[model samples]
Structure formats: structure tokens, C-alpha cells
Target chain A: MLHTVNKSPFERNSLDACLGLAKAGSAILLIEDGVVGAIKGTTIESKLTETMQSSKIYVLGPDLAARGLSEDKLVDGIQVVDYGGFVDLAAENTAVQSWL
Target chain B: MSEGTIKKFMYVNRKPPYGTVYALESLEVVLIGAAFDQDVSLAFIGDGVYQITKGQSTSDIGMKNFSPTYNALGDYDITKLYVEQESLTERGLSVDDLMDIVYEDEDDDWAEKPSIRVVSRAELADVIAGQDILLNF
Candidate 1:
């Protein structure tokens, strides 16, 4: 499994690089500005839903609500996680990728 | 620091919630870290401060702004959120103006909400050292 982390407003290079390597079963964590991706009706979300449909997406707790966003904001897919859970996600996935 | 016990991963959050794709992409990277089970932590500083702003409607951008997913973090377990005190003041903002997520309040409100810790650049280095991995987005 691939592990990904993002914390920017929305950098194409950040998501593209990670998504390119994703192989169906992967985890993506949203941090800081990265968690803002959890919001619905954003190009990033649609692209993720379209291309990275098979991957398991997660957003940092503080990052998500910090921006006043919830899991419901995302499409019908994409999973959300917290900081503690982020630690676990990093520990579980085999290969880790950090997209800036 | 044990053998494969603590896989520290530090992510840098430095951007606004809109006008760019860095923020969204960063989230995907963090989740990927969790899938790999790397103890992940994200530090927000600089322009990234606007990430926690409330009420985002990205419909105009022809996409869904998934900011609300931050609340679902409890599920994927990507916790560790830090903010630089300097950044807030430099950007002319306070914790109150930020989103309603867990934070270490500088004022110490001690509410049931999540705790957001405020720190300096030097302290940030200390936290970074504790991590086995660092990912700057």
C-alpha cells in the first residue's frame, strides 16, 4: 500500500505524483491546507473521485474541522482519519509518499 | 525510535484553502501516509494558515471543496496538528478566527473540542526531530 500526505491549498503536482503511483489499495491523508480537500465540489475531489476512486482517502481531524469541513462534504467515497489515526496509517502502509 | 515501532512522518501545511490545488493534494498525501502506517504529523505555517477558515463553497470552481472531511479524521487516524504562533500573528489572525477543529488554544479555553497546539519555529524543530519522517507540502 502507498501512503500519501498533503497540506497545501491545492497543488496539482502534490496529488498527481501520489495518484500516479497509487495501486488501488492506498491511503491519502489531508493535513493543514491539505485537509481542505475534504470539502465537496472542488476540482481536487472530482479528480480524486474520477482517477483515484479505488484509493482510501483520509483527512486530519484538526485540518478538516479547522477549515469547518466534515466527511459528509466529500463525495460518496473517500475515508477520513485523525492525527492519531494518521500515525497508524503511516505505520501500516508499506510505501509512504509525501506530496508537498 | 524502536525497530519499526515509531515511523514518524511530518507534513508541512503552507497554503490557503482555495486558489490552488496544493491544499487538496496535501490531504491525499497524508492519507497515503496513514495507509503505510507512518506516524504522521502536519505543521501549518505561512500562507497555509487560511486552511482552517470556516464556510467554504467551491461550487464556483466546478469542484467540491471537501473541507468538512477534516472532522472524519477520527476514522483514518491522522491526528497530530500543529500551528506556529508566529504565523497567526504575522498573518493578522488568531485561533478564534480559525476553523472549529481540535487545536491547542493559546488562551487555554479547555473546551471539549480538539486541542490545537501553538508553537514557535524552534519548538517546531524539536517536534520535527521526534519524527522519523518529514514531508513538506
Candidate 2:
């Protein structure tokens, strides 16, 4: 399954809930305001890094760019997927879960 | 429309009404998407359950009460509105707290049918997994 989180971690617990509930081997794609969670130095950075052990983490490239976040600033191991990549991820996974 | 061409689109709403513009903007997108004649469904999770709650009076807040607009969804041929059961329970709310939103089933001689389906968190996950497109708010 593919899980998508579109809310800021600082604002809502959507990212936490998703990280907690998502099974291992699932793909997580962050988009919209949710890209803030992808930053390297934030408080949630450690949790993201820990979760990356089991789940594949991804942040939408356009959403990060829109928020003025460059690829270099993202947490290590977090892959940046573009719009086409987003569609591919959706198609590849059996389901797309959105944490709004 | 060909059955194969029509895709499953689910609009996920997890924000509170009046606090932000997300709930309203999501509703507008749902309405606009209805014109495309695709299989569209709406899921209200977490704080989003407040959006369809009954007796919403925004007179003091000075914001337009758009909760009633959900009732009009049936008229647009978009009636699948799923509310997460666990979200309501966590918020100390029940099915009765929600507004009465019903749609007329054309196949059944226009009989009135309930639109708001209170589903479990697990059930809601399956619903989410079934969608081809997801719009989060």
C-alpha cells in the first residue's frame, strides 16, 4: 500500500499516525504542507529516520520546491518523487492512503 | 460513460470547519469533480467529522455555515459520503450528531436512501485503498 500525508507535522498528528499505523514495506509519500516533515533538522527528523528503516519514505518534489525546500535539506534516505513519480507510485501500490 | 474509463476518486477530509479553508475548498472541488461523471466518494476522518455535524451555527464566528451544502451533493449524483467511525468515537460523537443527508436512489424508484455511511477505521482503510485518485484536505 502507498500512504500519503498532506498535512504539516507541526500542525497536525497526521504524520505520526501514519508512521505508527503503516505496515512495513509500504511506501510513504509526503506532499503539500506535509513536505515540512521532510526537513533534516526538525524535531520529527529522528522519528522519520527511524521509520525509514521499515518503510520507504518519499516527498513530493514539487511540493517541496513550492515550500522553498531544496533536496539537500531533506532528511537522509528520503527520496524526492516528482508528479510523474507520484502517479507511478500510486499505480505501483495496491492502495493509496492519504493522511489529511 | 464506459465502465473502464471511469476511475474511483476519493476526497479525504480531515480538517475542522471554520478553523481553516480546507473543508470548504475540498467541498468545492468535490462539486466541480462531479461534472466529470466518475466514481467519486468522500471520507471524513478525524476533525473532519465536525464538518457534517448537526446544528452548526456560525452566526457568532462571522463565517458562512457551509455544512448544509453537503445535503446538495445528492442532487449532483454524488452520494457516497463515508464518515470514519473511530474518529467520531474519539471525539465523543455518534451517528445521530451528524446532519441527516439522504439521496434518492434512481434505480429504486427514487426512494430516499442514507448517504452518510459510518465506517470503521479498518474499513475506511480498505475504502482508501480501493480508490484510484485521492484528494486530501
Candidate 3:
């Protein structure tokens, strides 16, 4: 399953909930305000790093840029993808789970 | 728009109505998605259970009452509405407090069938596991 989280970790627990339920090898994409969780040194950074060990982590590049965050501010090992990549990821996964 | 393959699509609504437009916007997607003819289901969890509660009056809040839109979902052939039992209980709501959502079954002489299915959280999780796509809002 591909888990897509669009809420900020600071605002809601959607990312935490997704991380808890997502099986190993499942892909996680952060979009919209969810890009906040991908920023390095944020409160969720450590938890995200731990999650990355078991699941592939991605942050929407357009969303990050829209929030004035650069790829350099993202944690190591988290890939940045555009809308096309988002579509491709959804197609590649058997299911898309939107964590809200 | 793909043909010959029908994937299970589940829309997970976890937000309450009129908070930030997530609930209303999600409903619009569900309405439009009915044309795809895929197996679609709606799961109401957390605050989302409030979306279907009876006697919603947005007049005081000055927002258009979209709660009735859920009643129209049956007409669009989007009838599988799942309400998480725990969510309703936590909010002190019962099935009787929800709108009567029903659809006409063409296979059975167009008899009216209730569309809402109240299920435990565990059962809902099982339903989620079986889905091919989950749209969260």
C-alpha cells in the first residue's frame, strides 16, 4: 500500500497514525502541509528517520517549495518527487491509503 | 478511466464537517468518482462520524448545510457508508441519530435497502486492508 499523508504533523496525528499502521515496505508520501514533517530538525524528524528504516519515505517537491522549504532542508534518504512521480507511485502500489 | 479492471476504492473521512473544508471537498470527490463504476466505499472514523448525524443545522453557523448531500449519495450509486462503532460511541451518538440513507435495489424489485453499515474499528481495519485505493479526508 502507498500511504499518503497531507496534514502537518504539528497540527494532526495523521502522519503518526500512518506510520503506526503502514506495513514494512509500504511507501509513504508527504504532501500539502504534510511536508513539514519531512524537514530536518523538526520534532517529527527522528520518528520519520525510524520509519524510513522500514518504509520508503517521500516528500512532494512542489509542496515543499510552496512552503519555502528547499530539498536541502529535508532529512537524509528522503526522496523528493513531483506530481508525476506521485501519480507513478500510486500506479505502482496495489493500494493508495490517504491518511488525511 | 481504465476499463476491464475494477479496483476497490475506499474514502477514509476522519474530519468533522465545516472545520476546514476537508469533509465537504471529500464528498465532492466521492460524488464525481461514482462515474468511474469502481467498487467504492466510505468509512467514517474519528470526528468524521459527525458528518452523518441527524438534524444538522448550519444556519446558525452561516454555512450551507451539506449534511443532506450524504442522503443523496444513494442516488449516485455510492451507497456503501461505513460508520466506525467506536467513533460514534466516543461521541455519544447512536445509529438512530444518523440520517436514513437508503437505496433502491434493482435486482430485488427495487426494494429499499439501508446503505449505512455500522462496524467495529477492527472490522473497519479489515475493510481497509482489502481496499485497492484509500482517499483520506
Which candidate number maximizes DockQ?
A: 1
DockQ winner between 1 and 3, please give it. 1
Decide which is better by lDDT, 2 or 3.
Answer: 2
Runs in model 2 deviating more than 4 A are A1-100, B1-4
| Model 2 C-alpha lDDT per residue in residues B1-137, reported as the tens digit of each score | 53558899999998766656898999999998898899899999976876787776655335677888899999989889999987766544578878899999989999999999999999999999999999999
CA-only RMSD, every prediction: 16.0, 15.3, 15.4
The single-chain TM-score for chain B of candidate 1 is: 0.80
For every candidate, what is the interface RMSD in angstroms?
11.1, 13.8, 14.4
Residue pairs that clash (backbone atoms under 3 angstroms), model 2: none
TM-scores for candidates 1 onward, in order:
0.51, 0.58, 0.58
What are the runs in model 3 whose C-alpha is more than 4 Å off? A1-100
Taken over the whole model, the C-alpha lDDT of each candidate is 0.65, 0.83, 0.82
Q: Write the per-residue lDDT of candidate 1 for residues A43-71, one digit (tens) a residue.
A: 45566676555777776665555455555
Q: Grade the docking of candidate 3.
A: incorrect
